[model samples]
Structures are given as structure tokens and as C-alpha cells.
Target: MESEELLGNLGQEENGVPKKEKKSPLISLEKDLTFYADSIKEVAVEIMMEGISLHPIFIAHQHEVSIGEVILNKADLNTDWTIQASTLEEFIQKGIIHPDKKEQFLKTYKKPENYMCVFVVVPQGANFVYYPYPKEK
Candidate 1:
């Protein structure tokens, strides 16, 4: 690196200006017509898992997310696995993900004051969900 980084000052400057500031572009879920609609659930789950490997969301119930497979839990998901929403609802009386149902299964479980149901949150700002993982010493 050069001792003095300024070219305009010719080497007399003491402080160097930063390269640039960057901001992520805002996304509108409703109008976005690219690849986000079909991918919302998948991408959101990936964010929940904190950039780990991607796994299919395991409903942990009789009605499988995929055909032929029925049971998968957090522990069952591999370390490389990304987010996996609790299949907790599928087994319950009122199913969370039902076809033709207006609302998702957001009402069943009570959430702590600061947190939200993992299923409802978008992937963009969900660091809080994964922040507690591999808990500190």
C-alpha cells in the first residue's frame, strides 16, 4: 500500500476518504414480478437457517411436504440444511398450510413478546431467528 493514499493532495493528506457506501435496494413483495413470488417460501427459509445448506421444509406430519416422505424435524435436518418450518401445524387440528385457505397457520402458537412465528417472516430481516444458534459460552 502507498504510504499516503491521496492523489489530489500529492501525499500531504493525513486522512483517506472511504471507497464508497452501499445500500441494498428495497423490495416490494406485492409488485415484484421477477423470480421472488414462487421463491418467497424457499428464500425466507434459507434466511432463517442463516445461510446454511437448503433443506425441504419438514411438516413433521402425515401430509408430507414431498410425496412419499412424512417425518422430518430440526435435528433430522442436516447442519448444511437451511431453514425448516415446524411441521407442527400439519399434525394439529387446524392445518397451517391449507389449499384455498385465506390465512396461514399463524394463530395457533403464542409467540414470545419480541419474536414472530418463523413461517410468516420474510427472509430479508430474519437475523434474530438465527442469532441464538450455537449459543455462546
Candidate 2:
């Protein structure tokens, strides 16, 4: 049987609704990481806008890559003083992010000349604040 046909058969059910495959543990973990990453970004941006200096830590992932596959085995956030760095190499040397994703992370998170798009972790229960970064030149 062709691959597409075989896959269709695997998902078929008597009621005609395709049966969804169970998510692997790794996928579940990736989803969790994505959720946390978003939360951290939101909080970090807020903190950044309040005139408070932040050194937030983050595990940057490529936008083209599914978050469900990005590994976070070594990411460690300080929560208290995490600051956004300009390069993946900084995080990699600190052991806060995995080195294996260096290429994709750099490609997705930074602009040319090493300008970084901010993403960072913050302490839980931080007061909500609205501060936006000025448009990049």
C-alpha cells in the first residue's frame, strides 16, 4: 500500500471520524516549553518597558521549527535576574540552552549584525505592565 493510504487507514474509525494519534511524551514536553516560552516573553517585555533593567534567560527556538521538537534538556532560567543576550552562543556557553539547536535558534531569533529579538524568562506573579520596545532602526 502507498504511504498515504496506509496512514489514512491507520486513522480511520467505524464512525468515519479519523482517530487522532496519541501525542508522544516529547511532543507534550515541547508544547509545555512553548507555553512557558510565550509566558516568559510576555512578562519579559512588560518588565523591559517599565524602565527596569532585565537580564532574562531564554532558550530561543526557530520559528520554522515546531516547538514540539525543540529540546530543552539544559535550559535553566534564573527567574530573578534573567537578561536577554544578543547571541545563542552566550546561552550555549552558560549551559542555559542546548548547543545542538544553535543554527536554527540564531536564524530564527536574531537579525543580521547580531541584533536579537527579545525573549526571556521572568519570575512568576510579576505585575502586568505594558511597555513596548521602540521600532528597530
Candidate 3:
């Protein structure tokens, strides 16, 4: 009864199944991720073009964390991801990148003009990755 009240009353149960089908979590997560990527693509490009730094690093996270400016805030949506945009210089300033490792990161850094650097944070882990602007046709 409580569940029915929370989920809204479906017609009735038949053969041990509710009348209304519940959506799959995987499908919902996939949709949210797609929406997030589509919504942030343009903002990412603009961040790169601003000339703050040749390499702009973005963080896609679901929890509160230090560093970077929140370019996109979707906290109001339970399934959406929030994005924080930052540059290499800011990373160093924030102590995210130690001075010793700066050279190593720079050495392996891809062309900033061609790619948007993104640090994706998930329950599993986090990694620095890149995506191209002017998305393929």
C-alpha cells in the first residue's frame, strides 16, 4: 500500500507483476549521461576558447569537491551530473597537481585547441580524458 502510494497506483497486479512497468535504472542513467554530454559540449568549447589557458580541465561529478568553477549545475535533478571547469594553472594553484608532476602532465598533454580535457569522477574512480569540439557529423 505504501509502495503503491509512493509510486502512484497502477491498475493492479497480475501474475506477480505490477500493471505499470518500472523503468530500468540503466536506461535512466544512459539518458542522463547523454543529456549531460549534449548540454555541456558547447560550454566546454567556450571554456577552451576563452584563452584562460591552452588546456582547460573539466570535472564531471555527482558530489561536492574542491577546485574549479561550476560551469553546469544540475544538482536539482537527481540523476544529472554537475560539471566544474578549470584550467591547468588553476589545478596547480589548487594543489591538485603537484609542482613536480606539472611537467609530466604537460609533456603528455594533448593539443588544447583540438581537445577539451575532462576529468570524469564516478563511484568507480576518476580519470583525465579528452573530447573534440565541433562534434563529428
Candidate 4:
């Protein structure tokens, strides 16, 4: 997908009028994720090899990042699409894992060995989604 198509909307209001519906960051970036699935899976595997079992890769199409190891980025494009590889421990230290949701996160967390956990973040909200490797082909 073109960089403009990726970063153009961003859920921001256009011409001072709100969009009828704002697209979730995850939905907006689905194509990008699919396009980079192989690279994403490779990074997830590498993170697992590093001994961190519950790693989450954060995806956002904006700047001002200060966490996670950047596995994929397009800074040169001026579109600012980026994906950062992070671990459960790092999230806890950064307070991204709220104390109340810690138990829930752990209880419902999927195994990294079987799936790549993507922590999709947007201006509206964030969510954790899992994807299978090799696309089950």
C-alpha cells in the first residue's frame, strides 16, 4: 500500500468535520501487516529465541516511540510506519501492563511458540491480536 494511503486518515478529522467512522489502527494497517507477515514472523521467532516467551510486537503508524526493539520501520518514507518488538517484562516495567490487568493478560495470553502476539496501538485505543506463522498455507 502507498504511504499516503497508510498515514493519510489516522482517524483525524478532515477540514474540521469528523469522519463518519474512524478506522481502527489495526484495521487500517492490516494490509501492511499482511505484506510484512514473513518479516514479522521472523522477528517474533527471534524474540522467542532470546528466551522471552510472551513477547508482543507493537504496531503504529506514527512517531514518538520510546519502547521495544524496532523490527520494522519506514522512517525514510516520511509516513512513519513502525513496528516494535517488546516483551511482557518490558511492558510491566514501562507501566503499559496495568497492575489490574496483569492477571488477565497472563491468563488469556497466547503462546508465542504458536502465534505472534501483535499489540496494535492507535490514538483511539489498543488491542492484542495473534497471527499464525506461514499463514497456514
Q: Pick the candidate with the highest TM-score.
A: 4
Per-model TM-score on C-alpha atoms: 0.18, 0.27, 0.60, 0.68
Each model's C-alpha lDDT? 0.28, 0.36, 0.63, 0.64
Task: State, as a TM-score between 0 and 1, how close model 1 is to the true structure.
Answer: 0.18
For candidate 4, the 10 contiguous residues with the lowest summed lDDT are: 1-10
- Shift in Å, residue 126, candidate 1: 28
lDDT leaderboard ranking: 4, 3, 2, 1
- How do the residues 1-137 of candidate 2 rate in per-residue lDDT, one tens digit apiece? 13222123232354887556554333433444444454445544554566442333343322221111122333464221222322334445544346886666545543222222433222111111122333436
Candidate 4, which segments miss by more than 4 Å at Cα? 1-24, 76-80, 134-136
Please say which candidate is ahead in TM-score: 1 or 2.
2
Q: Per-residue CA lDDT of candidate 1, range 5-124, in tens?
A: 111123222367543433432232112212222333444355346643222222212111321122223245332122234433332323333544323433443322212223312212
Candidate 4 per-residue C-alpha lDDT over 23-76 given as tens digits, one digit per residue, 9 for 90 to 100:
554554666666667777777787678777546555554544566777777674
Clashes of 2: 4
> Order of candidates by TM-score, top first?
4, 3, 2, 1
lDDT of model 1 at position 110: 34
Regions of model 1 farther than 4 Å from truth = 1-56, 60-96, 100-104, 109-136
State residue 81's C-alpha deviation in candidate 3, in Å: 1.6
Better of 1 and 4 by lDDT: 4
Off by over 4 Å in 3: 1-41, 76-79, 123-125, 132-134
Model 1 per-residue lDDT at 61: 20
Clashes of 4: 0
Clashing pairs in 1: 53-80, 53-82, 59-87
